[model samples]
Target: MFKIHEIREIIKLIDQSSIKEFELEIEGSKVTIKKSGGVVEEKVQTIVAQAPAAPVAAAPAPAAQAAPVQPAAQPAANTQVPEENLHQILSPMVGTFYSAPEPGASAFVQVGDKVTPNKVVCIVEAMKLFNEIEAEVTGEIVKVLVQDGQLVEYGQPLFLVKPE
Candidate 1:
């Protein structure tokens, strides 16, 4: 099931982008978001395969929600400088984010850490494949957006850097 924050983030991103419709289906669950007349609407649906021997409980389907699009607010810490000045490191795929190489290991990068374009900043595990994410900009890390082991969506901002 998709978390509320995740759904909200998806909606926010869609509102900021030019895409009018977006859909994603995973493991029989589907989420669709559409923008119309300056309003955003989202529908979430879950499908379950059932066996004849045992019946599953019937639940009411979720209804689509429409919300007015609003400009996203910048975090207090990041408001010091304009967002245009910060370089955002974005995820290339949907996956779970890992700060360290393995359990109990030190994080690859931290706030205030200087990084080069080739620096491996984190790992994103998708479908059992661990992909190393690099800091494509030469700068000092300014913010770590997502927590360790958090599920991240494609194009999500993983880190913000102040270019040197």
Candidate 2:
């Protein structure tokens, strides 16, 4: 079972660390932590073993069990530069920052790019999932505060936009 305080601590760690993704294996259980848009999300899975009935005691002993496998968690994608002189766009969740949907892909928005409210300017990945972040104000991109794949904290400045 995942405890709320533990999760909060993990989130705080993620916020403070430069690493965007973190994983741990404990007692045959796997835990993964990711931060995006200033939000931290975690996933935990426990592997349980079932004992065989007495009737099977005579059978050859089962091969030694292997260590539990942790699922491959994908980090968040996309980070956009907000314009200067405009309201700064802050991360709402903790996760990895991406400049594009994938490696080698063009970024969603760039410096000098015009943005409007409701336009998806970036994406924050949490818990192996991608979440699109929209621009909340109409403006021109001025600066990018976070680098791609960098871990960000809650309320962290993502971009500085200049109003159009």
Candidate 3:
């Protein structure tokens, strides 16, 4: 998911370049960005694969929502929502998310799976290196938020856990 900051950078790049439109497609997800009337319009569409490349869930595009642009001396509206009672396991780096250790391997955890601090919950592959991601909170996995092979940004929520 492109963060608001990333989108801003893209807009700046577009404004400084001759390109009027940009589109990127990965797997079943597509992102189309266009410039209109000094405003940037981005349409992202994603289809969740039932038998996901692995047992992972889909990546987050909706979480990339942008806040209203504000001029200098003004503050933008806060768009962040707090996940109460749910401990979130976040990605530590920008990488491709993986639910299993390797191809054809079963996933590390699923919804309803119980986990504890330091327990490996998934893998994030960065630059061909696989880094194990741990569940920091003792809890029951309530949700797996990112798909296997999905590109995830640093600090992006990967799983939601209901604390024990």
Candidate 4:
């Protein structure tokens, strides 16, 4: 029979090791442990010489349901824009925004520059990976909302574009 102290010791050992799975069997008692990446799962199983049959019962039928009715809703929400006539290009992820590819290099796109959908506008560094941001709409950049090496939030406006 495994004691509480033995189980604690085993858990400590498993925590200290990088091994993902461990099993032990002694005197008809079995223990199985598994770890996923850094998560730990402990399971214990005991086998008896004889097992009793379980009683069965009939399950009730599910209740009848009605179909849902669609409600009339507004198709679009309106946002009042300033007189600048510019559409905002928002950041898709939270990271450090960079205007240029490298230090002292010219920016990928500048204010008053025409940008196409395929044009690379900037780089955002997240989790040690440098991700290049692309312009999704073809337009002329009217304003840069963020500075180089600045920390940006998700969905924050990075650039303003004036449609051609």
Which candidate wins on TM-score? 1
Worst 10 residues of 2 by lDDT: 61-70
Better of 3 and 4 by TM-score: 3
Task: Give lDDT tens digits, candidate 2, residues 89-151.
Answer: 777665677878888999998877899999887788765567888889998777777778876
How far residue 147's Cα lies from its native spot in candidate 2, in Å, is: 0.7
Could you give candidate 3's per-residue lDDT for residues 1-164 as a string of tens digits? 54456445444433332333445465665655544443433344631111102111333222234212112221112223355878878877556789999999999998778999988999987645789999998988877777777666556678888888
Q: In model 1, what is the error at residue 151, expressed in angstroms?
A: 0.4
lDDT of 1 by residue, 1-164 (tens): 76667666555554443344556677666767655554433444642221112121332122222222222234213536566899988877656889999999999998889999999999998656789999998998888888888766566688889999
Can you tell me which runs of candidate 4 are displaced by over 4 Å? Answer: 1-84
Worst 10 residues of 4 by lDDT: 60-69
Tens-place lDDT per residue, model 4, 16-100, is 3232344567886665554444343444554211112222232211112211111213211223445278776776655678989
Off by more than 4 A, model 2? 1-84
Report lDDT (Cα) of residue 22, candidate 2.
50
Tell me the lDDT of candidate 2: 0.59
- What's the C-alpha lDDT at position 13 in model 1? 50
How does model 4 score by TM-score? Answer: 0.50
TM-score, one value per model: 0.55, 0.53, 0.51, 0.50
- Each candidate: what lDDT? 0.67, 0.59, 0.60, 0.59
